[model samples]
Target: MSLFQVQGLVKRFGGLLATDHVDLSVAHGEIHALIGPNGAGKTTLVHQISGLLAPDAGRVLLDGDDITALPMHRRVAKGLSRCFQVTRIFPAQTVRDNLLLAVQAHSGSSFRFLQPRSQAHGLYEAADRLAERVGLQGCMDGIAGALPHGAQRTLDVALALACAPKLLLLDEPMAGMGPEESQQMVQLIDSLRQDMAVLLIEHDMEAVFRLADRISVLVYGRVLTAGTPHEIRSNAEVQAVYLGTETLEATP
Candidate 1:
């Protein structure tokens, strides 16, 4: 079974149907990319998936359980974690401390019988692992906000990893990054399939082509197509609707 599934989701805003019967799936160990032009309802779909917005119809199933009415935090507990377009790291804190906090939140009963110091040590180990996972070990002592833009985004990804997610939701993780930073982020994302499935929402077609196992095209609040990278690249309809009109990258 798929690790995550969005079935016939529907949402509206008074006069507008922002999300119209959208269906999507992310399988275990798959990197599924979602791409579309502006106002295609990608953000709206993500908000519903992340529990930031409620859907008017359809169901969200994570690991065979329904989570449509669950709140954001509840969804996180169920192994659904998201990284937003904007970085969401604790600015004043050191990267180590930020990761420590995230680790502690998900530690649950594992540290219950241990003394405070032992628990601290356990949290520290988990934090260090997360830092290492994202290539942020060198920046662990650095203040999160003071780091370079790319590093800050990387830290935000680490924070989400703390949840030990089964499905990782990444929204525009490479936004506001330079070419070097974008490359680094791409590598970090590529490495994630070993641990969990990723549902990526991004406009960077170059990265999408390179990383996605499968790509889903969203147009006018509906899925226009879903296929492998080569198939998507070769699709005439996709090129006409999106790739043709888009440069797919920004100034480095």
Candidate 2:
């Protein structure tokens, strides 16, 4: 059975049909890339899956269980986690503290203000291991806001890892990064695919092509096609709708 299934998903905003009867399935340990031009409802689909928005029609199933009605926090508790396109961090806190807070949240404990940092040893240890996994071990003592852009992005992934999710949704993870940073992000994501299913929304075609086991092309709030990298590269319909004739001609 598929790890996640979205069947006939539909969403509307007044007269605009944001997602039009979309059907998508993701298998376990697969990196599924969702790609499209601007306003293709990619983000809208993310919102729906992450429980930020409700679908007007269809069902979302995780591990064969329907989760269409579950709220965001409930979904997180059920092992679904997401990272936003923009960096979401505790700007005032050190990287270690930020990760500790995430670990505490994941552990289902209320924040305790008077407790010493050392008292949260278990959480700190787990956070430290996650930080190392994402290449943030060296910067643990730095203020989160003071890190370089690439390190900050790594921290974002680490926070999601702290959630111990079964399915991870990443939205534009490579956005606004230099070539080196983008490469690092790609490697980080590649390292993660062994343990979890990933639903990735990215505008960087190169990164998508590099990492995706399969690609779904969305256009005008509908899925135009889905296939392997080779098939998508050669698909006439996909090229016509998104790549254009000139760009298609340039592809080898």
Query: Best by TM-score, which number?
Result: 2
Q: What TM-score, over all chains together, does every model reach?
A: 0.93, 0.95
Give the root-mean-square deviation of each candidate in angstroms. 3.0, 1.8
lDDT of 1 by residue, 1-252 (tens): 898999999999998898899999999999999999999999999999999999999999999999999999999999999999989989999999798878988887353424576647868888898898999999888999899999999999999999999999999999989989999999999999999999999988888888999999999999999999877787889888887735433221
Q: Could you give me the TM-score of model 2 versus the true structure?
A: 0.95
| Model 2, span 51-143: residue lDDT tens | 999999999999878999999999988878999989999988999989988998998766995787677778878988988889888889999
| Poorly placed runs, candidate 2 (over 4 Å) | 244-252
C-alpha lDDT of all candidate models, in order: 0.91, 0.89
Candidate 1 local Cα displacement, residue 188, angstroms: 0.6
Q: What is the lDDT of residue 35 in candidate 2?
A: 87
Give per-candidate clash totals. Answer: 0, 0
Error of 1 at 173 (Å): 0.4
Off by over 4 Å in 1: 109-119, 245-252
